[model samples]
Target: MLKMAKKHNMCFALIKLSQTHKQQLPAWLHCGALLRTYHKLKDACLKQIHEVKSIKDLLKVSNRPTTVPHHWESHDCICGLCVSDRLAGCKNPHKCISTVAVIINNLTPKFNPFYCPINDGLTLTHCRLEKNTRARTQHRGDIIFDPSVSETLQLAECFRIFAGDTRTAQAPAHRLQRPNQGQGQQEPPIEIYTDSSCINNGKNNAQCGSGIWFGENNPLNKAIRITGKTQSNQAGEVAAILIGL
Candidate 1:
């Protein structure tokens, strides 16, 4: 069955070619001649080759058709679907569309010339052919997300949320070491450092408040407030730490 189908396809293709080039073909080469050749080839295959259950097995016993030439691979060329070997040396190559169209129309009985496969396989009943052609020609790249705007905004919002959660209370005493008074107990002099800055210092958009406790027992027993120009609340917090240090 597979062998028969392949033979039938080849015969149909040859018939299509012969009918298309009837006027240009030699007197001896015609449909009758092709039909006789086809029968001889078909008979030889049946007698010499064993029957195959599938197309793949049939291909093992048959010679495959040659590939379409490079020039005829693309749809934009003058050949427009016709094989290169069929159109060689034609004077009015531009006028080959009529011959090509006839062959295609016969070979692919299921194809609808008025429809576009990309348009959901629908028949192009009312579409403008010129516009569709231009659109297809101009298509370039696939659509993708634009990361510049949305990504930047999301990052900024996240930073703002994090900055709002800074500790507002005074520094814990556990952070500092205890003072020593083995001899006559005299209290160590308290040295307080203070500075202030804003997150967006120059812009005055957001402000950050920070204090440190610094002493002998307390690492930062002396409290300091840092307030001034800053880019972010984090920067203001950093400034307060520096002042305490």
Candidate 2:
């Protein structure tokens, strides 16, 4: 009836029609413009639905009291704090904390391998880790540290050698030996060290730099300050490795 009134330039408020007028409206009058309006309305309805669902999920996981102090023990009723902080005046304001209040009070604790702070700061900011964005072929295993074991000490020694610890005056006896094959000894493997640095890391204006080091005073050694919007410590590390290769 409203569509008909609007189409005929009739006053919508003045029309006195019952619910039966809904079916009496011509189907042809509801074709083109009505379909477009319905599509727009559908989008708005879906947006509201998604917003409600997101709020529900957020509240479900959050440790917040959503009601007045008296009704907090009840499971069915929501708190007045959802609408406004002072909606329900009560003495115990602590029992009416919102989700945002709970988050702010707790400082957004870390949950590893998912939503966590990029740095060690106790801020409300978080970074999301999507499973699809990670490499499917590679597996990142857990790390175990034990200084008491002899194998751990041996592994540390090997790591020091691979990382080019110049504190050692000479290479170990095992590393100096060459494999003998048919009366000919094979040459030792070439070792290169690559590293990266990022200043103001985890920020939008972060700067990243990479460096590749061969032997002392080697001509192949290079230092590069990376330039681009894609600047992070990980990106710099990958860039240094690629350049070294």
Candidate 3:
């Protein structure tokens, strides 16, 4: 009925009809704008749906809690810490006690092979890589040691050779060769001693140095010392052993 208007003002008035005139307006006029808005909203929803190809993708896009998703006891929840962070070795804060705390508390302790600091490759059964990044479902071995006993004070098996003991340092030495009694060969034992010193053990600007002593029981023996970038005790120990060997 409003299309019958002859003046421009009359057409504008018809387009801006009051609430009462809405009931009488042509149905097609109201539908065009509504369809456009509905199409825009539907396109946005479809775009979101198409972006997600799998459940994992959907979860990645979801708003999740910052806390751990599963109720796992890092040490004893029956699920070990390795379950999180893609098996890269569980770094859960809860486990700092049952694990590193033993060392801090000056007690003798064994550890889960996955978190075993130096011996992960030897203790973790499934450590197949040259790097000890992954651990097996079952551990390989448990190393027993006492922190109360100092490495220096402990009676090394090697010194027993000088005491006229018949047994050797190691039952089957990997680094030592046996002297044949029949050959009556007499060769001086080679000693390679290593030690590390840190100016400040755990500070930001700490300094660390390692000392290597190589030679027989002679006054002419010499020592070499080296400084490293990191000042950590572990880093120094590892460096000393690596360089000494």
Candidate with top lDDT is 2
lDDT of 2 by residue, 1-245 (tens): 65644455432121112222222322222211212232343223223332323323333323445323433533233455433323432333233224223322332121111122233222222222233223333455332321221111221222221232223222111212334655665667889999999999999999999999998999999999998899899999999999998
Give the better candidate number (1 or 3) by TM-score: 3
Q: Where's the lowest-lDDT run of ten residues in candidate 2?
A: 108-117
Q: What C-alpha lDDT do the candidate models reach, one value each?
A: 0.34, 0.42, 0.35
Kindly give the number of clashing pairs for every candidate.
Answer: 26, 2, 0
lDDT by residue (98-138, candidate 1, tens digit) is: 32333223322112121222222222333444555656688
Ranking of all predicted structures according to lDDT, beginning with the best and ending with the worst: 2, 3, 1
Cα displacement (Å) at residue 125, model 1:
98
In candidate 1, clashing pairs total 26
How high a TM-score does candidate 2 get?
A: 0.25
Q: Considering summed lDDT, which 10 consecutive residues are worst modelled in model 3?
A: 107-116
Tell me, by TM-score, which candidate is best.
2
Ranking by TM-score: 2, 3, 1
Say what the RMSD of model 2 is: 28.5
